[model samples]
Target chain A: PNADAYGAARERLRNQARPAGSLGILEEVGARLAGIFGTIDVRLDRKIVITCAGDHGICAEGVSRFPQKVTPQMVYNFVGGGASVSVLARHAGAEVRVADLGVDWDFAPDLPIYHKKVRKGTANFAAVPAMTREEAVRSIEAGIEIVDELTAEGPVHLIGTGDMGIGNTSPSTAIIAAYSNIPVPELTGRGTGIDDDGLRKKIAAIEKGLALHRPDPKDPVGVLEKVGGLEIGGLAGLVIGAAAHGIPVVCDGLIATAGALIACELAPSARPYLFAGHNSVEVGHRYMLEHLGLQPLLHLEFRLGEGTGAALAMTLMDAATRILAEIKTFAEVGINDAQ
Target chain B: PNADAYGAARERLRNQARPAGSLGILEEVGARLAGIFGTIDVRLDRKIVITCAGDHGICAEGVSRFPQKVTPQMVYNFVGGGASVSVLARHAGAEVRVADLGVDWDFAPDLPIYHKKVRKGTANFAAVPAMTREEAVRSIEAGIEIVDELTAEGPVHLIGTGDMGIGNTSPSTAIIAAYSNIPVPELTGRGTGIDDDGLRKKIAAIEKGLALHRPDPKDPVGVLEKVGGLEIGGLAGLVIGAAAHGIPVVCDGLIATAGALIACELAPSARPYLFAGHNSVEVGHRYMLEHLGLQPLLHLEFRLGEGTGAALAMTLMDAATRILAEIKTFAEVGINDAQ
Candidate 1:
């Protein structure tokens, strides 16, 4: 990050025709964007939320409220532009790119989605590793490839991470447990609103998976191979790929931030590129964002995932860029500064 | 608010394709809108932020970082659509109506703004009541009249409160001190980034103003006459008027919420009409919103009191309405709900 450029942006904002720092965090966010882009002016005209869809093998453990088949169904919804992410992304003037990461389904050549399936589905982590380390690497590499392909059309100003997979949060909780000292119960939540019995089952399943795999926190790839889903790996790759290209990325809810965890671990420099789209009701999400040292842009008690929060925040980022680049300075407007 | 209609809206949302209560607080907010409108389906087409601009007597207390003249200057900016509120309210698809309530300057008659000035300015609150009770009553009634005139074109679906007055936080802190038991120091913050010395002076000024007037907590009108700005009274009237018409109102920040406190106290029914736009960094705002039992829509650390945050939240409320009103239910989509 360009500290000098960040300071310059903040100085320019301070000279705007308003009370000093009255814009509050929006000013700081704009300044940070300036530093990230290495310029005083930033523009976010081209925005997109890349949602990766995969199936969790943990469904075999009865950890999810929805059936695993719902994964492919939601992908169909995304392709039809009928999902929450699609609606919100459109509202934010952002496009949605659906990635078929590992949804236990095959598609025809005419499908309106990205074809990057790593496997049919992860192995049921309650009994075995979700995928081999090579598969984990491949899943994330798919994400990097997708990002590069998308940016080739033009400069993708901002990207948000999204996911649509049933039973995904079970693995996300397990990933948080491996990386942080937070307990499984403290990290677990009723993903998509499960009843009490399902919650108990999910807690038990995660404890079993953790005990069996004993994944290493330091080895993010190993953790992904052991307990993470393929879409999670892909989402992580999206973050790393965006960082490698010097583009800022936003991640939505617990599912997306779980991928952020892997990406940051794999490439610690990705920290500066990642933005927490919103704080989810999921208990582990707070720990994940805190561990990553990210303050989410929104806190709406959201847990539906699908990059909805990230898409909503993209609009604010665009507004922030406008505030930084469009507003007249005190010198330009001949307005006196605060005495 | 119609509890029956609120329950009906919740039921309708529960039947949506997504899981029950997936939208979280947004679902509740939309349901409240439904109850306020006495319908299961609510539409927020005509939206506006009625910003009351005025001068504060507390300017004589040296409690602010900016000059009192900035009040009218910023109002000019509002008319030019160059202020933050104008930009954000436009972005949120809400109209901005600036009402001059004791602004200490006379706008040209042809200027596109509301002429509701209660007085040239209030008496200096450091040594006397900010306004006579009659002036206070007139200022608030002006707000009510504006709401009626604005909605006369058509029913306004949502109304937001905004204020532009230098050193207005002094009277706001005094209002909280009168009603709440929270100590002034704990509830006081440096509004608009005052230095340590300015913050001290603001606290001392509030303490002195409170001791001098001894404003009765039970008589909200008396409290406004003693310590509130004319624009604050106007904002309070906006809330009461919105409730009288069964419309939901969003309040910007500290100054706006100070008005909300008075409105809710005067007519407890207005509680249902009030939505916190965002929690201000101003310490007194916490007690004000808590006293109103209102949860803010955003927590952007925004302290620029121009209905900017309320404008931003208007977009979210629109999104929430879309989510509740759009999106195919599971049966319509032929998708299975959680098992």
Candidate 2:
């Protein structure tokens, strides 16, 4: 992000017809937007939410409430405009793009879904590496290529990270655990509303995976291959791709944020272009957000991730940029700020 | 609120193609909106934000950073589409309605503002009662009348409470201090960027006024007469009026919530129709919302209370209602919830 542009935007915001810094987080958001767009004239008119789906073999441990078949089912629901993110993205006036990273199902050829399959599904990290290093790199590249293809079609102003996978939260939480000394149990949460026994099983599985893999935080690709899902890798690529194209990325809840953590590790410059969409109910969501130094825009206590948080947050980004563009300065309004 | 309608709405929400209660706070908001509208079909279209401007003689006590003249100036800014709320309301697709309850400045008839001024301003509560009980009732009735008139023109779907009054926070905090045993200074905050000395003076003034007025929580009207701005009283009426008309009211920051407190105390039945738009940075805002048993939708830390928070919340209300109206059910998509 351009610091000079951010500073200039802040000065402009301070002069708007309101008390200085009274818009609170919005003022910071508007300035950051100006920095990202490299101008005060920021337009988030063309927005898209990328909902990436994959399957997790970790579901074999009974870590989630739903079966792995639900992943492909949800992708169809997303395309059919029936999912939560579908309605929300439509409400936000953004198009929803469904991508299959490695779901363990074959979608029909006529379906309007991106067929970017890296593998059938990730291997259970508790017993083996989630994916090969080559597959992990390929997954990220697929995401980057998606963004490139979309922007090639038009000037894509913003992108939102979304995910659909059974037991995906297991890998998301493990990613956070690898970055911090926080206990696996502390970072783990009940995905899709699990019982106490299921939660305990989840914690033990993550602990086992961590113990076996001993993933290094330094080599993010190695970590991704060892314990990350294909969709997560794609989402990380989405973040890096968005930053590379100078477009802002609104990262959804825990899973998308896990992807973001990996993206930032690989390319620290992408950190400046990202917005934590909301503080989810997942215990590790806020912890991971703090690690990334991103302040979430919404606190709706949302736990369902399909870019819903990102879609809602896009409205705020629109408001912030519109504020910078539409609101007149105190001088234009002939109002004395000191008075 | 209609309990039967709310339950029915919740049932429908559960039948939609998502996890049961996964949308979290939004699911509740959608159901409550259905209850308010008395059906599963909720329409938040044709939204309006009523910004009632008044003045406080309490400004003479040095409790605020800006002069009382800034109140009328802001009303002009709001009318001219140059204020923070103006841009935000426009962004949210809501119309801005500026009303004068007790502003000191006089305006020509050509200006597009509601001419409902009860008095030039209220008396300093630190020295005497803010208004006669008769004037307090009139202010609230003025708010109710405005809502009635607007709805009479068309089927109004939603209303948001906003206020513009210098030293208004002093009286607002006083209203809360009357109900709670919390320290007066704890409830008081820097209004419009006041210095520590100004804050000390504000707290001292509120404490002095509460001691002098001895406002009772049971007699809400008496409390308003003793320690409320005309805009606050008007906003209280707005909540009551919105409830009587079955239109949801999105209550904005400290001053707006202070008015809502008075409204709920006077008519407990109206409490169900109110939504705390966003938790402001004001010290007493959340405390007052808690007292009203209201949960804010957004946590943007917004302090510019010209219906700005309410306008932003209207979009969420739209999204929540649209979720119920647009998203497909499991049966419609031929998907089994158990899977």
Candidate 3:
């Protein structure tokens, strides 16, 4: 953090003609943005959310309502600019980049998505380990390369994380349960508003994955290799890569937060680089956030995990940055401060 | 609310390619806005926040950190477009209309504010009623006329409530305590970050007003006449007028919520027409929202009573409306539903 810039931002806020501290959390948001950029005049441009599309073989267990085919179809929708993340990213003045992580289906060579498929899809963790350790490492490196390539044009200030894989939440729950002693039922939710029967199946499947993989709780990489999905590993690498380059990563919802948890477990130093986009309606979301010690910026009760929440939060963060940079001080505006 | 429009909006959302209810509470927000406008296609072209500026007479009890003189000066700040609400409202693409609900000091006759001063200020409520019943009725009417005149050309679709008054939280705490049997200390917060001594004084002041006025909890108008500020009265009327015109009123933090409580208490039908912008950091805000059966859209830890929170929420509401009206359904987009 730049003490000088933080001081300058606080001074400007103090003299903004309204009562001091009246802006509440916004004043802190402004000061923090200033600290992030190491300057009082912080501005965000050319923001992008990387939506990694993949598939979950665990969908065959009837854990999710939708078929795994929806993943590739949603990737097509992303290419045609019709997906939720597409609309919301554009709405928030940010671009979207949909990358193929490990979907089971193959795309045409001419498709616009960058192909870094570690495999067709992860092995159903309920039956076996999801991926080999080497494959997991390669997934992380692939995410790092994606961010590095995107920022090669110019430094991207904010990076949002999104994933599209049906039944991925089952694996997400497994990963959290593998590390923490939280019960599967406590960490499970209606992934797609499932019925009581479906939820029971989902919880059973998660427990089966834990029993089959026997993931080492002390080893984050082993846990990812055993129980986590490819997109999850990629998101973890994206967070680590962003921290390596001194940029902030805005995490979407539960799946992305699972990836973030893996990243934080892998490297505790990467924790500060992550920002929660919104509190998810998923029952396990509060547990994950409490584990992270982060608060989300919005609460619209969004259950979709498409980086849509991240896109909206990018706009609010931009607004906070603008306030820190644009508003005039008492000395500049010739207004008396409240006494 | 229009049932047909609500149904249409839901149908559109259901077929929008996302999972049903994946948008969660935003789906309800969209449907409500559609119902409010009597169309599935809802648009807000001209939105305005009425920032009612006033002063409280209870400051004489040594309850606030700042003097009462800061009220008009901040009003000047609002007019000059330099206050937090001014900057945030403009940032959210909403116009601000600052009116003189009752400031202790007078402005120039041709100043760029509506001169609807109910009185120089309220009487010292520690010893007497704040205003007579006639003055209370006139203040409410003045607020109604302000909205009526502003929407004379075309009805404003959204109205935001903001207030400026020193020592006003004292009265707000008193209002909440009057209706609910909650203790004052449990309901009160450090308004404007008052010190321990100032907080003690504020609680003592509220207790004095309650002891002296003995305002009836059942009689909201009588309570306002005895204990509430003129701006609070005006805000209640603004809410009523917005409801009368079939517009959505986005309620801000604590002080504005105090006014909203009065409005809902006066006309029960007005309750559905109001949207909570954010939950206030003030502890009583929870009690108030629970009483109204309303959940705020955002929880950014904002306690600023300016329509700033409302402005931010207006942006979100606009986003929800656009998603409802503009997004293509499954038939239009040629996309299969997740199921």
Candidate 4:
């Protein structure tokens, strides 16, 4: 990111017809866009949201209210343009691209989703590692590969990270615990609306997995291998790849922010290109966002994490960039600002 | 608002493919739209934002950072489609309609603005009533008359209220003070980036206005005549008119919401039709929203009051209504929810 461009963009925004600093986060977004693109004349016409789906082994412990099969079903709904994210992306004038990272079910060869499965699924982390370290690396590479394929076709202005897996939030919580001194109970939440017993089981399952793996915070990849979901890893790669390409990535909800936290840990340069789409209802989401030093753009209490939040916020990004590029300065509008 | 339709919408939303309460504020907005439109199938295709421009006599007290001349200057910016609200409303697929209720300057007859001037401007509220009770009523009636003329052309799906006036915050704070026992100091804020001395002067002006007027809370018309600006009264009528026509009205920041507060007091039924666009940095705005039992849709800390906040959140309303009408139910998608 270019600091000079960021400063220049801020100066430009200060001269817009409105009072300085009145647009709030939109102004910040404009400056950040200028920083990322190294120019204030950046266009974000090609917007895309990639929702990665992969089953979590933690569902065997009854950690989620929905069945694991819902993962593939939702993926079908996504491709069929019937899910929340699909509807929202269309409303935002952005395209929805689905990816199969490590779902247990086999999709047909003609399915529209990206065929990037690393394994059927990972082993249960309560009794064994979620995946070998190599598999974790593969999942991250898959996301980067998707970015490469996308950029080859066209200049992608923005990418929003989304996730789908029934028990995914459990691993998201576990990953947050790996990085912070916060207890598992504090980081745990009702994934897919779990009951009291389901909540207790989720907490215990994370505690047991953490105790067995004892994942080191210094080794982010090792921690992901021990407890993170494949979709989470893929999302982390999406963040890293977006930053590598100088594209802004909006991370949705708890699991997506967990992915962002890992991406920031792996590559500190990715931090500036990331935007937390919203503050999710999940308690652990705030912790993960704080860990990443990111402020969410919206606080609508969204917990449906199929990139719906990102899709909604992409419109604000549109507003921000337009304010930077379109709105005439005070001098151009002939308004005396000395008053 | 139709309670039965609202209940039916909730039931329908629960049956959607995602988990029952996952969409959060969007879901609430969906159900609220159902209530207002008296059906689950509400379409917000024709949207409009009415920005009422007036001048404040309270500028005589050195209560603002911007000069009073800027009110007409911004009115020109709004009509010329260069202001923040104009750009954002275009982005949100809404039309910008400028209404000159009591601006201090005269706009040309061919400027393409609503010719509904009630007066040149309000009197200095710190020393005298802002307007006569009859003029206040006339200003509000002008707003309702705009709605009537708009509906005559075609049905308006949504109407957003905005305001443009110099030192209008002084009168807004005075209005809030008239309704609440909260200290004037706590309710006061630096409108348009005033310094510490300007802030002190603003607080003193509002305090003096309220002490002299002693506006009766029960008589909302007298309250507007005593302490509110003409644009504020006009916005109050916009809210009332929107509710009368069963259209959802998204109220922008401080000045817009003060109008909503007065409208709710005048016509208790208008309360259900109001949606706060975003929480403003202005302290008294939240107090007024709370008084009307309204929750803001966005919390972007936006303080630019030319309906920019309303324009941004209007897209969310579009998404919400689309979610309610478009997403397939679990049964329709053949996804078993009993699992």
Q: Give TM-scores for every candidate, taking all chains together and pairing residue i with residue i.
A: 0.96, 0.99, 0.95, 0.98
For candidate 2, the lDDT comes to 0.91
Pairs that collide in candidate 1 are none
Candidate 1: segments with Cα more than 4 A from true spot? A1-5, B1-5, B37-43
Model 2 over residues B248-330: C-alpha lDDT tens digits?
99999999999999999999989888998999999988789888888899999888889999999999999889877777788
Q: How accurate locally is residue A331 in candidate 1, as Cα lDDT from 0 to 100?
A: 68
Per-residue C-alpha lDDT of model 4 across residues A228-314, encoded as one tens digit per residue: 989888999999999989899999999888888888999998999999889999999999888888778888888899999998889
Question: What tens-digit string does per-residue lDDT give for candidate 2 at A85-204?
Answer: 998998898999999999999998789988899999999999999999999999999999999999999999999999999899999999999998699988998988889999988998
Interface RMSD, in order shown: 1.7, 1.4, 2.0, 1.3
lDDT of 1 by residue, B15-133 (tens): 76666777677888888888888886677889999889889878888888888888888888888777788778877888998999989987898888889999988888879999999
Enumerate the candidates' DockQ scores in order. Answer: 0.59, 0.77, 0.54, 0.75
Pull out the clashing pairs in model 2: none
The DockQ-based CAPRI class assigned to model 1 is medium
For candidate 4 chain A, which ten residues in a row score worst on lDDT? A330-339
Model 2 chain A scores worst on lDDT over the 10 consecutive residues at A330-339
Ranking by TM-score: 2, 4, 1, 3
When sorted by lDDT, best at the front, the candidate numbers are 4, 2, 1, 3
**Which pairs of residues collide in candidate 3?**
none
Candidate 3 C-alpha lDDT tens digits along A129-224: 889999889888888888888888787988999888888888888887876779899989898778898898899888988987788977888998
* Cα deviation of B208, candidate 2, in Å: 0.6
Candidate 4 residue A265 Cα shift, in angstroms, is: 0.6
